[model samples]
Target: MPTPIPPGSANETALLDLLRRHPRVLLTGPPGSGKTTLVHRVATRLADQGQACHCLAADPGLPGFGPPGAICLGRWDPRLDEGGGWRLETIEALATLDSARFRLPLVEAVRRLAARTEAGPLLIDAPGVERGIGGAELLAALVNASHAGAVVRLAPENAPDPYAQERVALGLEVLKLPAAPEARHPGHQLRTQRRTEAWDTYLTEAVEQSLDLVDLAIVGTPPPHDVTAAWHRRQAGLLDATGRTLAMGEVLALEGGRLKLLAPPLGDTPRTLVIRDAMRHSEGHLGTARPYRAPYPATPDEPSLRLPLQEAVDGPRPTLRLDGVRATLVNGVFGDPLLHLRLRHRKRSLLFDLGDPGRLPARLAHQVSDVFISHAHFDHIGGFLWLLRSRIGDYTPCRVYGPPGLAGHLDGLMRGILWDRVEEKAPRFEVFELHDERLAHYRLVAGQPMKALSPREVDDGVLHVEPGFRVRAVTLDHGTPVLAFAFEPDVEVKVRKERLDAHGWAPGPWLGELKQHVHAGVDETVIELPDGSQRTVAELAQHLLLSQPGKRLVYATDFGDTPDNRERLLRLARGAEVLFCEASFREDQAEQARRTGHLTARGCGEIAAAAAVGQLVPFHFSRRHVDDVGELYEEIRRHFPRLAATPGSDPYSEVD
Candidate 1:
């Protein structure tokens, strides 16, 4: 189960041995989890071994993963057809998509593709998600219809899969998934630059190239749109006879079957064979449509912007846990505004924010018991649908606590996709909405049309009350209802071993009961010591128990620093051991911060100082400061100097 492919080696001897027996090997993982890369790598190794291998692109956004005639669905470009990429998307598959008979056409398409393939073992490349319900379902169907022999998932056990529980029932051998060591999220802007750089490199230099289209063929399943226009209108890559990308070219004229194109200079024509129509898109192309096959997908012309920030996608990281909790910036510190506070108290797990949690490790997503959303902004809650889909069909209920309209937001998200087939078993959603000094609660099970829930009036401000801790919430001025939460753990009772030994009573399980009774203030409660002697809980605890206040953590972000709001935060965050707050801008951009319902570093420091927090971890900086977030930190540090590490720190460092 260790990685079949070892580190520093692309050697496929082990992989080829497995491929002889397994016909269809499906690869899946989270975004940047390297599922596609693994498929490509494994296919290359198989080809080197003289085994005929074809990789099927189950995810449309990525295609041409194998040699020409490879099976690919979605994103059919007219120019790339000459590469021999087999279009797996059938007309019937597109027509009957999401219908009551959804699986039939897709299953037929898979079978048809398998029938035509004359080459080696097939590798199906599936779209990876930390939690992708639709993708998983689609993968399950493809694997079953294709008669896959094995699945090589590139993620942990909690990775998204529709048939995760039913795998054994389906006779599928689940290979041990391995994390790609080279995987790293380049971030939004950086990823965009990388794509642009590829385009820029392809477009460098200047020349007019003649492309003979008489023998050209397209690589994708032609869309319903006019095929000629689809070719003429798209950006293309000119390929050589050997199928190597020679240069990028913009189509000039396609008259009389002779294609005129402009591209970088080449010494000679080298007999251009095909023009690839598709251009790989980076995540930052805000309104661009990514038409991956789906029950929930924007149209080709529909501009739906989804901004996801990845943490582990970039590389392996040092532990971010602080005081028994993991505090991760959902977005980069200088990137989007998303913070994830993972509280691991005992076996219980709690989450803060629903930002771009697509980057969250699959292993962590499975442990989440509750999520607290600060606001409903796209940058704050963009990862909501992914998180929900990840937990789909989960028997465990995950509670969502948020400001007003939380339930409605979740309802709209669920209704966006076609769930006609899997409505009976969906994740149980328990949403709690915060009103001023009150809370309303609602529960929803997916697959049914959601209705507006009139939250029952709970006058108490407490959002959650656990056995050893309680959570309180308040709305802030964030142009919308933004809630800030505080977790207050109960005081701890330490049994005085010295006093117990002095009393000639040996410590035992009775001390635990005594401590519990002491915390409960049950004076009449009696307990037996090791010697079987009975004593009142109050008397036993009088000498043996010493109480200490438990810790508190406050998470605040995406809010304007109005005086009233500041005063409220000060009261709620008072005496917090840690305060994770947003410092979106610097003092120079104070006006901009206020206009955006955000806060400056100076403002965050002032609020933290007023709250008298032990530590202030500032984040959610503006993109303008992407050059360096250190300046904002320095500005905030001026107010709350680095006294925690300083020698002989002055008492003045302690805020009121």
Candidate 2:
């Protein structure tokens, strides 16, 4: 482990220097590591230099800018206080916090904060759980979403570094500093006392208010369903539409279709009431309340119905999950043709086409590791700049595969942008263009010209291959050569926990060996166990393994309804679990579809039926059908009975 810098005023100068290079910094350490003290010192120094600093208090357990059970955002400006002392004024609670269930929401809140155009540096005070797997995962999620370029770690004397592995994994600049001399671990009693004092201070001007339940939405946890039980108190936060906490209170009563809360006076009616952990106030002191254990009844499933095309296009978006991938249409059917596919358990994603990605969230855009371009139309590639902007600080290179001339198009697009201040940390792109059984490669990075690499020959139309899946591409004429892609996964072998438990065997690394043997068809091979024992691979496979076939998804769009195009599409899409095909015109307007190099509703349905696909999802509809798009769905339903009613609906479940 590297030795940390000694504690002194020089450390403050080093931190300020780091802040100059990286505007956003995350301060993380274990309990009693003086992370909060360091945050104060940094804020004071910045304020002394006439710079404002934004601070995010993320540890719900420890009271900082906000009370316990809440994540707060606050700022320290030099002009706010006349004395020029360090003070975090204008604090707002961003979200009601829970350790296990609210991690993702917290990360999202951080992302939104980082995207804002604030005038000062942002310092995040992370929780003190830097030693376990859960802590590591939480830290990683926060760092990724916070857009933080550096992390400052504070450790006690002679303590092992808890963030060493994660620093290297995330490629973040880290500065290690020693803990403060006065830092000491607080006991359980002291922690509870501090929480009580915080609550008292926060609720000094308390008042009672009765609110109608019908006008407010309940977030976080819902009240118990049984109305007859004795009314119990639960800590709650009132928030507006923007997620700013209006007030914190305790639910005193829930009856007569109304809620009574004891809290500070509210300026206006809150939009939401976020119920947190059970708590109560007794004789001016806060304490834990009894837990509610009665299970709420399950919500009944809604019946599926075929909605009109206009309603479907304007309705809420849906996410469909196949065996190993989750798919979403970027802009529904009426806008552009972009399909987002995220591999389950892979922490990575692929974009079927580079259509306008402005609707995609920042986190999702950052996860895109590869992109497949059907053609380089303006609508198909207009949002490439947005994608690039979202991944400015990410180190992973995004690989793009497309038809011929794609490298040249990307080179021209990249050359238009000025990279004068772009650093080496900017995102990179690896472009692969397929032309006549050969794949040409081009590398793109900010502040550098595109570099061409040697071309590689590909057979069987396999353009890209990974360990668990492969992507195959084929060209179809759509006025221009357009690419269609098929994503096929290898066979899956899963462990049967019931069988292993029945044999009184514990799961370990041997399961991976068993899977490898089964996947490689080496069932007769012997497997070694961790306990210095040996077992036959065949016996383990018979007792504990279940083999299943993998699913395939196909994406074909923007191709005319010609015989040649139909044949190529069917050859690539046959037996696919889900086929996302284009239906840009009505059945009677086949001539218009052909003229525009698109497919009609009837043509899409016929192709899906002929290819024997399990489900057909028709998208990229013409705007003219906004009023009477039902006819298009009816036409497709006449030919393909397994057509999805709406893009939001799950097409895979219909086949099952």
Candidate 3:
């Protein structure tokens, strides 16, 4: 550990002088380096000199001046100092431990605070993320967003500086200081203990209050808007319209459109309740609560078929599978149309549409790497902003594929936002626009306008190809041109476990290499065994490998029921394991479906049957038929007997 900078010493004086010269400063270091303590001392010294100083606690995990899972802004008043500190004046619970959820909002908050002319220097206490690629990107975004003139780093001697590249790139002044002598690293248990203490202190003057849920807008992790049921107790932060935290409370009960919460007495009515992690009070300590699981109810009209994708109301769940890939709907069948496919053995996921991405949890939303847009309707592309928000600080680029003019539409959306504070580390979007015979490419980055790249000629309507699968697209008419997509995987090659065991061979990277060679049609390569024996690829493949066709999934939506569209859809969806087609209206409302450039339930079924698909999963129903969606299902079953139930629509009574 490094020696402490003694109080009233020349080093301390120089640090104070450096802080005074910068209007905004970031106090950053690894955990246990005493960055929080240094912030307090600097604020106190500035206050002692009659200078008004503001402190922004930006670390949600171990906030020094606010409740846990929130960013706090407060002022230091020397007159009220009696060894105890002043409470946080304003709090914003943007997210818990995930910085991606709150990155953009946090930057806006800092810019607003720094713009205030009446306030003195702003001292920002940044989170302790001084290592790894994620940490470096996070810190760079913060430095750029806050527009901090200087960064005061506190670490032990001989510690490598993580922000050396950023400091030079941004032209920022660096101040190195020694860690506090009393600094001690906090474990997870200790961190939780401290957070509970902060919560307890925040509710010292709290009381129980009941308010009408209809009168207040719910933010963050809100319950289903249409469902009416008792939810498990959860922690929440009350805020007024101006984004100021009114009180921190626990949701005691929710019934009859009324919400009961225990929090400090409010002088004004709160307009919004920002839900935090599920929590409950045990004895006197705040602890984690079991997750809330809703009961599944069968549709009143049909006993065997469950509701239309009830799981979408709660969150995404794997309702169906195409081989090893799990599929989910971002919103229910009656809601927006968005299909999420969790790829097999991959950390990343794919999106068929961008509808209501807020329906996904923060963790899963960040895993989205590829987006396929059928059309540019608000219901299809409106969630692009939320997707961008969840991926702002991540290093992976999000690739988007859509119909013609998609690049222009997405570029217009990106240009609408003010990106002055965004840095080079922010999220990047690669948009691919599918034309008649070629795909146009465009690149978009925060703080810069979209740039067009050279177009690539489409080969057999194939849009994207990877190691195991390829994505192909075809244009359909939906008043406007809409692109229907097919996800086709290459032939699967599985090793025969019995043969491997008989040969005394164990699974290893060699098997993967063998599979790859087989996939590439290589037959002459030699394969070495663990026993120092070698065999030709042809001989080894014949003895060990079994080849089978990979499962295929097709996504078609928002297209008119016409001969041209039907032919195109059939060609793309033929022999697919599952076809997610849109049945927007029932047969009784065929005129309405035709006018809206959508397919009736009967038309959707005919197409599925013509394509000879294994299963037909219908979605994107017209809201006008929400009350009688069972009829639509029956209509589809009439033409295609292999209709499948919606995801999470199994007859199970309770959620696991």
> CA lDDT of 230 in candidate 1?
34
Better of 2 and 3 by lDDT: 3
Question: Per-residue lDDT of 1-656 in model 1, one digit per residue for the tens?
Answer: 67564651432344455677787676655556666556556655554555556655643222333211113432222234452233333211121112112334445555666555554587766544333355556656767766788876565345455456645555777765655555533333333344345344435665777766655543333222222433342345444565434444555556666666666665444344333223332332211111222121112432221122112222111124443354555544544454555543233467777666654554455567888888778777777777777666545878889998888888888778777666555767788888876677787777775544566655446788765568888788888878888877676666676887787875444555566566556789878665557889877767678778867878888899899789878888988887878888999998998899999989988888887888776767676764444566678887875212111111111011
Number of the top candidate by TM-score?
A: 2
Question: Which candidate would rank higher by TM-score, 2 or 3?
Answer: 2
Among all windows of 10 consecutive residues in model 3, the one with the lowest summed lDDT is 647-656
lDDT tens per residue, model 3, 208-263: 89989887888765657454432434677788887776777877778777888788
Q: Which sections of candidate 1 miss by over 4 Å?
A: 1-324, 341-347, 451-460, 492-547, 642-656
Clashing pairs in 2: none
Model 3: C-alpha RMSD to truth?
Answer: 13.2
For model 2, residues 472-494, the per-residue Cα lDDT tens digits are: 99999989989999988786667
Question: Deviation in angstroms for 273 in model 1?
Answer: 41
1 versus 3: better lDDT goes to: 3
How many pairs in model 1 have backbone atoms within 3 A of each other, for residues 3 or more apart or on separate chains, i.e. clashes? 8
| Clashes (N, CA, C under 3 Å) per candidate | 8, 0, 1
| Candidate 1 TM-score, C-alpha based | 0.46
Model 2 residue 452 distance off true place after TM-score fit, in angstroms: 2.5
